[model samples]
Target: MSKKNKDIEVRIEETNRTIKGTNYVINQLSIGKKLVGEVMTLGAKEHEAFLGDEDLGSYKSVDLAIEAILLQHNLHD
Candidate 1:
């Protein structure tokens, strides 16, 4: 594939998580190290608030970001 085409591609991986007592759908993109993005399609205002806080903002890489999300859900077990 061409470099130009690669830049337009977005690969997403889905996982279930819960933040602040509500379940959320987490989407992880296979992009650059610091290019992690997330979307929570199911949750209340508190869940969104927690996700936007400084504790979640400390992750600097996509892998770490995913890890942080997993940790939030206690999914590591």
Candidate 2:
């Protein structure tokens, strides 16, 4: 295969893998695997952060953010 064709094939494979991973994560979250992990930040202000419509209070700190998510999941269960 040509180099261009090989690159395209690689991209297609990567896309397929990403789609599969996303589907698996969705399935797990649906099964109640909430509070996955904490987001790594360089500052106090977050640029982009959201997980569904889950109102998980304010982000006081990384630990607090994680704690709030855990509480949310515990309460929902």
Best by TM-score: 1
Please provide, for model 1 over 1-77, each residue's C-alpha lDDT reduced to its tens digit, 9 standing for 90 to 100. Answer: 65553343445677788778986766654444433446444423222212333345533344555556545534322
RMSD of each: 10.9, 16.8
C-alpha lDDT of all candidate models, in order: 0.48, 0.36
lDDT of 2 by residue, 1-77 (tens): 65553321101011111343452111112223333323233245531122346544446455555455456655765
Candidate that would win on lDDT: 1
Q: Model 1 — TM-score against the truth?
A: 0.38
TM for candidate 2 is: 0.36
For each candidate in turn, the TM-score is 0.38, 0.36
lDDT (Cα, 0-100) at 50 in candidate 2: 24
Clashing pairs in 1: none
Clashes of each: 0, 0
